[model samples]
Target: MSTQKKAIVFLADGAEEMEFTISVDVLRRAKINVTVVGVSLKNDYATCSRGVKIIPDVKLERNTFKAEDYDALIVPGGAGGAKTLAEHETIQKLVMEFYEKKKIIAFVCAGTLVAKAAGVPHKHKVTSYPAGVREQLVNVYNYSEDRVVVDENVITSRGPGTTFLFALTIVENLIDVETSNTLRKEMLTHENL
Candidate 1:
């Protein structure tokens, strides 16, 4: 069987704009198929926390794509957005399905709580922006203050400030060091990386 890499990024009402855009950009640069899925009925338009309005490629409910069809699922962080995503039953089911299939599930900032809400917790290292949130996750997973943390199938990062690192790490995980390194230089993130 041929292996094809596809990814889905979930967008909520108040998602972190930078995290979402950076991830999609980096993943696409790595040649990974990326689908932006909105978690709201008004999926065509989502206003991020910082007042950036974004139009998702499609609504999650309307998308024909299934969990098994994608290699990874990425969730961006924004307190309101993460809470909305965590409370949604459909997103919860999707996350659980991905977890069961051993697919990559990534999150940034407050998005880590979505994983926790989905009942996917491991002792492996994980991280989020807020120190308090990190402290809370430490009880369930080995938490760190690092900018990016990848443990098994779970990948996480701090927040908007680390969006590049987070996206590059995702590329590294889904693609390869060579591809990620090349993109880093192209994106002028080589020094920071």
Candidate 2:
């Protein structure tokens, strides 16, 4: 066995650039094998919310994922991207598979809606942007105002402002506290964070 950790980040048009890029950057910094996947039918580049065009490392195909091949799934949120993700059955299945396997499933901003749609159980503690909105969340999970909330294998964070914290938390989960802290110090990931 290679013993290398692997993660997949799914991207749709209008995904929040900061959330997707920062989290990927942090994970790569920790030596994780991170794959950026485009969700379009062609599996091509996705235009972000800020108009940043990103070419994915791969394209996701329905019924083709072997969930056991990866250690984590990450979803970055924008209004349009999250809506698209929430409506995709394949993405939903992938999310649920990761959850069922007890692997890390991380979401940022409205991406939390994707988890809700996938029926990923939460321990009544999760966070997302526009904190008061709970309409999308089911009765099983309660929303939190914290920057990032980790309930077992499910990790959630607020908007772009907290992307660093979100990414660092993921690093801690996949690697260790010492590595996460060292990266935090090296990156100087904001004074308040």
Candidate 3:
């Protein structure tokens, strides 16, 4: 309903610190109103994979919010983060609703499970972390085993090691490629975005 770039990220029990922070900060830098919504087991701060605690802007269990409040939902990857996200019925439902509307949804690293559980990619191109997890990612498993995958409104990136490029790709997804490239050029001297 509003034109503001309300981007909400789901921070479950163990999100990857880099994936969560990089995506949120870059989106904010690109002028999106980013909110870290914690999906905690007990309505508390989210504990990242790196052990850093993030106090959320909102708690999914305690709030009555619209999936439409945000234009996109970013799910960061971590062993526990992805597993926890994939198990949540509400989150999976919201993700499906967003995808059904053709809104943007992104998952980086092991978070790939959440996107899949939400049913975003039936057979489209997608990506995820390339370790033992690659074999388990949903759909197009053989396609993005090595690179960042962008299939229309659904974007996927490798992992925290690729956080910079991943965040920039998300910026490209929500805003425009030109803006993403410009920021990349500005951020990295030798970068050819």
TM-score of each: 0.93, 0.92, 0.90
Pairs that collide, model 2: none
Query: Of the candidates shown, which would achieve the greatest TM-score relative to the real structure?
Result: 1
What TM-score does prediction 2 earn? 0.92
Better of 1 and 3 by lDDT: 1
Per-residue lDDT tens digits for candidate 3, residues 57-173, read: 888887865666678888899989899999898888988887877778888999887887776656767888878677776434435665577787788888987877877877777
Flag clash pairs in model 1.
none
Rank by TM-score, highest first: 1, 2, 3
Where is model 2 more than 4 Å wrong at Cα?
Answer: 41-43, 131-134, 138-140
| Model 1 C-alpha lDDT per residue in residues 1-193, reported as the tens digit of each score | 1465899998988898998889898898888999888887354689999989988888877766677899999999988789899998888888889878988999999999899888886766889977556766778988888999988888999999998999888888887788889998999999966
lDDT of 2 by residue, 1-193 (tens): 2587899998899899999999999999988999988886333688889989899887776336767999999999988788888899989999999999999999999999999889886564788887443556635587777899998999999899999999999989987888789898889874679
Could you tell me the lDDT of residue 162 within candidate 3? 80
In model 3, pairs of residues that clash are none
- Model 1 scores worst on lDDT over the 10 consecutive residues at 129-138
List all candidate RMSDs to the true structure: 1.9, 2.3, 2.4
Candidate 3, which ten residues in sequence have the lowest lDDT sum? 138-147
True-structure Cα RMSD, model 2: 2.3
